[model samples]
Target: MSEHKPYTYVTASIHEGVTRFDVSFCTSEMSAKAFGGDGERPFLTLSSTEAHMTVTTTGGGPVTEQDVTLAREIFTASARYLANCERLHAEQPVNPTDQTTPSGEVAA
Candidate 1:
C-alpha cells in the first residue's frame, strides 16, 4: 500500500462569503502533519467572485498567476485527474457545463 493514505489534494471552503481553498502537493507524512493546512506548497483563496479573480497564495509566496496554468493540456489534465482522486465533499454540484474548463481558454 502507498504511504500517503489521504493523498495530496485540493480543498474548497467558504466562510463569510469568501471562497477559500488549499492545494496540497506535498506527500511526505511528517511534512503533511506539520503544515496543518496542506503542507507548505501554497494555499489559494478565491473570494466570491462573479467575474473578477485575484489569485493569492498563503505565506505571501511569490507565485505568479502565470504559474497557475503553464500548459493548457497539462493543467486541464491535472484538474480532471484530481477531481477523481481528491477526497472532496463539494457543497456545489459539479457543473459539467462549466465553461471555466481550461481547455476552452475562456470561461463563458
Candidate 2:
C-alpha cells in the first residue's frame, strides 16, 4: 500500500477589522514520490474586508494553476459572520455620563 502525506499549515489573521486566512495542504517530497509523483498539491489563501473577500489556490504539478473558488466561498462566509458581529457590537449604546464617578472624580 502507498502511504499518503498529510497536508500542513493553516493561518488566520484579523487586522483593523479585516480578516485574512491562508491554508496549505500537500504531500511532502517522499509522499509525492509514493503517490506516483505528486497528487493534488493544494495551496489556498483568503482575505476578506468589510466589503468583500478574495481567495486563491494552487493544485498539483509545477505549472498547475491554483483553484480559488472554494477559498473565496469560505472567506465570504467568514466575513459575513464577522461583519454581523461587528454591527451588533456597534449598535450597543454607551452613556458618556457614565465615564465620571459620583465622587467628583473622572473614571479612567
Per-residue C-alpha lDDT of model 2 across residues 1-108, encoded as one tens digit per residue: 255655556688999999998655442221111112255444443322221222223434443222445546766986997799676545433445455444445555
lDDT string for model 1 (13-49, tens) is 9999999977654443322111114344443332221
Every model's TM-score? 0.22, 0.27
Least well predicted 10-residue stretch by lDDT in candidate 2: 28-37
lDDT score of residue 80 within candidate 1: 88
What are the clashing pairs of model 1? none
Candidate 2 clash pair list: 57-66
Q: Give the residue spans of candidate 2 off by over 4 A.
A: 1-67, 93-108
Q: Which candidate has the top score in TM-score?
A: 2
